[model samples]
Each structure stands twice: as structure tokens, then as C-alpha cells.
Target: MGELGEVPNQLQSFRVQDAKCYCCNHSHIHPHSGESLPCDRQLVYETFKKWWSAGAEEGSEQHLERFNTLVRQRVAPKVARGLGIALPFHYVVYMAVFCMVPWLSDFIALWAETRDHRAAVSMWSLRHFIAWGIVGVALLFALRMCVWLWKLGSRIEKRLDSRWCAVFIVAPLSFFGVCALWLPIGISLAATPEDNPLPVFLFIAAIAITALVWRAPKWQEPLPSKQPSPHVFQRKEDNATFSI
Candidate 1:
């Protein structure tokens, strides 16, 4: 963890060790201070600082009202806008990865059987449980990768100031890139008529999962803008009074 002095005073109250700013995809070092703070946390810190310095005394109705106003006017809209631009890429990445998992598991299983013929025997014999365990582990790994890719997309989205333009450019390139990479595999798998139905099933499952994730209540909820504690402001007020 870095010392508090490494962070800018405006952002120090909200600093978390090793935290990265999603907007810039950098550690919580402020550009000037060389300490990083996450985007939303930075917004909250700035908003509160602005409200306090503007003489919105804590515990008063005016303080609460002003803080809320600043949040609505400055913070909520930016957060919402960024999420709106980022979420579609996240969904697409997740769906694509989910659809790839079954194929990946099958590939690994085939490789394992090739390495040791006994593993192939175990795959179909009474020891089939061992094969299933392999599939289960692969599924877990694929799911973890999906989440990582989703977060990566969000971080990339935040870094772009012109999100719409970036999306238009990146989305098509990503789509074609995935297709080109998968084409040979798809054609090879197609030669095996028995495997034809598997792709369809995987595609449908991916769509269903993506839809569920999209409709999740947590996704629809707004990012929380945390208010500064009243005691912080009270202490500042007491100090100012003493100085006067």
C-alpha cells in the first residue's frame, strides 16, 4: 500500500490500496499525484469536496440537497452514460465465450485421451465419472474467463472518450476476428455429423444465459454515490471556527 501523501488531497478520502481507475485503466494514482482512484470513487470524492468547500454545512437540509443536486447533475449521468455504452460489448463477449466453452472442454478431453489411451478407456467405462470431472473443471474455467473478459471490455470502454465511435470500429473487427479464428474449427467439426447439433445447443444456452444476466436486477440498478460522513464535515467546521 502507498502512503496517503502519494494521493491527491481531493481523492485521499476515497483511496483504496491497489485499486485501479476504470476510466483510465490505471492504478489509483491521480495524474498529478501519481496515486490512482477508481472512477466512481473519484467522482464521489470530488462531489463531496465541492459541496463542503462551497459552504454546504453538514447535517443541514441545504447540505443534503446540494450534495444530491451535485450528484444528479454531475455524477449519475456520466456513470449511467458510460455503463450504457459498455454493457453491450460485455454481453456480446460473455455470450461468445459461453458458446465456446463446450467446444473447449471437448478439445481438452480429446487431448487428455490422446496422451494416455487408458484415459480414453476410463472416459467410456465405469470410471466415466473422471471424464465428467474434467468437463466440470473446464466449465468453471470458461465461466471465470467470461467474467474477466466482460470486465476487460468495461475497462476498455471507460478509457475511450468517443465510445460510440470506438464501438462501431471495434465491434465489427472483433466479430470478424472471432469468426476467422473459429472458421477452421467449425469446418472440421462439421465433417463429423454427430457434432452438428452441439453447436446449436451451445448457441441457445449462451443466448439464454446472456439474457438472464442482462435482466438481472443488479445490472439495472444505478451505481451508488456514497455521501461523506457527517463527522468529517463537523470536524472541518470546528477547525474553521477555531481558526477564525
Candidate 2:
């Protein structure tokens, strides 16, 4: 037979060729028969040689450069984009709107109170102003936490774990919904103290919406099928398949 060690290196060379085209980045090419892939063997050698010369073998600068390039070229860009997008940055903008929601509530209440009375008592306006100022401050703090969450998310994403998906996306959305309902109810209750039915009804609706949104996805996922029985594979003496 032919020389022994030539087989493995030949196989590795084929492996490089079977990979998608480095220049055109296409995946349509077919590998040659009895080979892992079909391409110029010299080019495959050159690619690795360049990386080696660049310092991929030792604790050197070129090693990291080659590795980073390989990942950036092969790894999906959408995943990187998702990690980079920092959803918290966007939600903080939304939370800015959310925090202001209460002040809008206060403004509406003030407008209604002032419509009939030109000389309303200073106490009423002062109380609403203080309430709104507190809401604004709380929202600013929430916004800061949101910025922190985004930075944290970026850190988690770099680790390349599943928790990044849950914390960065799911947790923030849930918090937003919770705050949406609770903030309105708390402010309404605080501002009126007892006799308003309208805000209470609104609060209940917000809460119901939050609950539905949180749990609705559980029903949408499909269940896995049962595993196959063990006796399905039976070895045949006469018709055995062999790997060469």
C-alpha cells in the first residue's frame, strides 16, 4: 500500500477544502470522491502557513488575531448583533416614557381640578407637584438601573451563555409591565387616597394584561416526541455495513 502517514494529512487538507469558499464565501461546492473536500491543496497549506507565521502556534499577537478573525468570519453576525444591541438602552428610553406616564396622569388631574376653579387652594397643586416630583426621581433611578442592566447584559453576552437571553430580554420586559401597572395604581391611590373608582378599574386592567403577557408563551412551545425503543437495531452477520 501507499505510505502510512500520508492519509491523515491528506484528509486534513480535504477538510479545509470542504469548508465554504474563503474568497467568495459560498457553500455550494462539492468535495471530491474519497476526499473530505475538493479544492487546491496548496491554498489550504498556505492559509495555515500564513496563520502560523503570524504567530498562531505560541503566546504571540498573530495567534489572537487569527482566532478572532476565524470567529468573526464563521460565527453568525446576528448573534453578535443581538449581544451588541443592548436592549436595555432601548428600554431605558421607553422607561423614560413610562416614568413620565405618572406625571401625565398628574397633569390631567390638575387640568380637571383647575377647569372649574380659577383660584384653587395651593395645597392641592403642591401635593400633586410633590407626588410627580417623587415619581420623576424614582424613574430617574430606574433609568440608571436600566443603564446598569444594559452594561451587565453586555458582560453576560461576552460570556456566551443562555442566561443572557433571559435576563436581558425577558426580565426587563416583565419589569416594564409590572411598573406600568403598579406606578399608576400607587399614584392614583396616593393622589385620591380613597374615593376614585376609575383609577382602580384602570389598575386592574393593567395588572390583567401583565399577567396574560407573562404566561401566554408557555402554551405556544411544542412538546418533544417519545424516544424510540432499544430493540429497533438488530445486527446482521451477512449484511453488515463496514467503515473503511
Candidate 3:
């Protein structure tokens, strides 16, 4: 066991094991940031893109300075131009992807289980189908309401308030909270770990993303000058050339 004056390799390994790693969410066995370090400027990039797309005046020095400050603060300015076009369709695409959650969950679970054992899978087939059927019905009703809200949002933009968007978030989150009250009891009854956990995760992610969608920036109140009253424009002398 002895080499003359040799340091032990096991002691070095032990020290390495005890070291702390800052990246990749892994324990020590490597130097700091064994993976790529966090890019702190991603938020700044998003903020810059937001303001740039919001019609920031290029010729104005004040506008450029303000843009820099806003980027520093990581503020998402009003969506404009190309971003405006994309923003309107974001909810539609988000809803489409989330709507498939229930069906996808069922398909994945069934495929994995059937491949393992046919008879065991058949035992729960009808029950699983009924559960997913209920999920589909719920999704259909929710999707219908979301579509209505999207249409209404276009109309409501003229008024410039986010209350409707906030209300939309409230309904889904409240529904999820109510459903979650029963999740503990349901999970306890499942015979195996491979049962339906995706629904709960999907619900939470859906609510969180919905909240993010509405958090960009509040709609600006329309200027009073543009919306002059009907009587304001009714002039007595339409042809009068009144020089200042």
C-alpha cells in the first residue's frame, strides 16, 4: 500500500467532490460554471427590442437616451409595427399549443403502458378515456371563451384598459386552484407513478404563461386631442383665413 512520500489520489477526489459548482445545477467535481455562465444581458436585449419596435424616434437624442435607460431597466415598451402584428397572434398560438395538453398526455401514457403490457393497459383503458374526454370537454369550453376574449381585446384596445386581460387570468387560475384541491386525493389513489401528472403541470404552466402574456405593458390612454367632441369641430366660418 505504500509508495515512498506519495500523496493519496482518494484525498484529492474527496476534495473535488466537496467543491461547489455554480452552473448546470450540479454538485462540485468541476470548477466554477462548468457549463456556460448566465447571460445577464438577455433581459436588456428583450427590452431594447421592445422599445425599438415601439416606434422610438431615431432623430431625437432624448428618445435615444430614454431608450438606453429603459433597456437598462429591462422594460418591455409598447408593442408596435411588426411586434404589434405578432402580439395579436401570440395568444392564438399559445392557446392552440396548450389545448393539446390533455390529448397528448393521454397518448403518451397509453403508448408507454401498452408497450409494457397489453392486459394491464386494457384494464384502465375505458376509465382513462372517460377522464381525457372530460378534459377535452373542459378544454373546448375554455378555448371558446378564449377566442371570444381575443376578439373582444381587439375592440377594447380603443378604450385602453387591461382589466379584461386580468379578468381572463383570474378565471383559469381560480379553476386550477379549485381542481388542485382534489389532486392530492387523486394522486394517492393511483396504483403506479406513471399515472396522469402532466395535467397538473400543464395547468400550472398555462396559468403562469397567461399571466406573462398580460404583463408586457399597460395599453396607453388615447390622447384627448385626437378624440375631440363632435361639437368642437363644428365651426361657424369654414372658409375664414385667420392668420396669427
Candidate 4:
């Protein structure tokens, strides 16, 4: 939770302006957004930052107002917990530390297996040298490609709404990632074969996914720009429900 930052000690206060918070997804609908609640706005802040960094006029009153609504309705309460703070707060960092556990455990297991395999291989053998060289090159290339894809996705995601971003970009990249991760095992098995078709197929699939995400329209056909209906959010302050 260090990434969430320390909670401020200022006492919570009410605003003179009676402006109510609207649902982040629905602009016109007023919702219950009390001050010093809903402190976790990491995803909303991150999304807004991506747009702001891309030269979006986030400082403009119109954009800022919309962003404020999002922060209050969707994001701020998580960060505001235990901190005496006002509503309509701003933030950009997102929650990512939760992901560390799953990948960390898997990596430890992988490292153990790799160490075991290393003990069996003789450095003097020509076959061992060639295999290591190929695997190293492949891993390096894969790493480069994955990084590029991540950057590309970040840029492309900026153009779309969150829902569309998830549909066109996130879903495809997830599949491509799964394929890329699993295919390395197949490549290792087919190492003796002069040509490994799995790598080629994986490469082509990844490229296709990237291309599709890049070309997909950020949003559907534009409709009349009218205020949206807001949805009410009920706070779970009492930990009555336990979640893992």
C-alpha cells in the first residue's frame, strides 16, 4: 500500500458549493460521494494521466470538471481512507503490487527448475552451448517484442474509452501473452528440429493482435453528446463483507 501514499492528517471538511458527485460512467446522474471516503482511485487516475500526458487539455475547466467527477465517484475514496481529506481529489498512480504475488511465486518455481537443469548441463558440450545461445537469443527477442507491445498498447489505449480499450486491446494482448508464454515450452521440446514452427506462429499471432488493436476504432459511432445518467454507489465502510 506504500504506492497508495500516506494518508493526510487534515480533518475532513465540507465544500461551500453544493455540487454533488455524478457516477464516473454516467455524467448527469448524481451519486452519494461524501468527503473522506473512497480513497482508492488508482485506475481512474492512471487513465486520466495517460490522456493528460498525451497532450489532452486536462487543465481546461471542462475536462477538469469531468475528471473531478470521475475521481470522486470512482477513485478517491480508497486513497482517502484514514486521511482527513476533501472530495474531488486528484491522483494518477494505480494499484499494481497485488500482481506481484502470483508472478513472484511462479518465478521462484521456474528458477528452481532452471537451476536443476543447469546442474545437469556440461559447459564443454557443443550441444549445450548451442541450446543456451538459441534460448538466450529467443528470450531477448521475446522480451523486446513484449516491451514494444506494451508501449504500443499504452499509446493506443489513450485514444479509446476504458471499456473499448479493454475490448480491443486488453483482451487480445492477454491471449497473445498466454500464447507467447506457453509456446516457449513447445519451442524447447522442438529444439532438436532444425525449424521450430511454434515460434513463427506465435510471432505472427502477436503481430496480428497488435495490428488489430492499433487499427480498431477507439470508440463506436459518436452519438449526441448529452449528459449521462449517474448511478449511486453504496459505501462498504464497515467491512461487513469479507473479500479476498
- What's the C-alpha lDDT at position 84 in model 1? 34
Any idea what lDDT model 3 has? 0.40
Model 3 regions lying over 4 Å from their true place: 1-123, 131-135, 147-244
RMSD of 3: 25.0
Segments in model 2 whose C-alpha atoms lie over 4 Å from true places: 1-86, 98-109, 112-123, 126-244
Model 3 clashing-pair count: 0
Point out the higher-scoring one by lDDT: 3 or 4.
3
Evaluate residue 51 in candidate 3 and report its C-alpha lDDT on the 0 to 100 scale.
58
Residue 210, model 4: lDDT of 44
Alpha-carbon error at 44 in model 4, in Å?
34
Order by lDDT, highest first: 2, 1, 3, 4
Give candidate 2's error at residue 60 in angstroms.
Answer: 14
Scored by lDDT, model 2 comes in at 0.43
Give lDDT tens digits, candidate 1, residues 1-244: 0121122222323312123334444444455777645555446445655756556455444544455446545665455445434335455556655656666666566556754445434333322232233333334334433443444455455667555655565566555644443343345334534324443444344445545544544322244344543332322211111110
User: Each candidate's root-mean-square deviation in Å?
Assistant: 17.7, 17.0, 25.0, 17.2
- The per-model lDDT (C-alpha) reads 0.42, 0.43, 0.40, 0.38
Give a tens-digit lDDT track for model 3, residues 112-205: 6665555545544543553443343344335434444444454454345665665565567546743553343345335434444444444444
Question: Candidate 1's error at 12, in angstroms?
Answer: 12
Worst 10 residues of 4 by lDDT: 8-17
* lDDT for 174 (candidate 1): 53
What is the C-alpha local distance difference test score of candidate 1? 0.42
Compared with the true structure, what per-residue lDDT tens digits does model 4 show for residues 1-244? Answer: 1122222111111111222322322332334554333322334445655664546554433333455455454444444542222111121011222323344554445444554334223221323233333333333334434444554555565556354663577557755765565465446535644333444444444445544533443321122122221432333232222211
Error in Å for residue 95 of model 3: 7.4
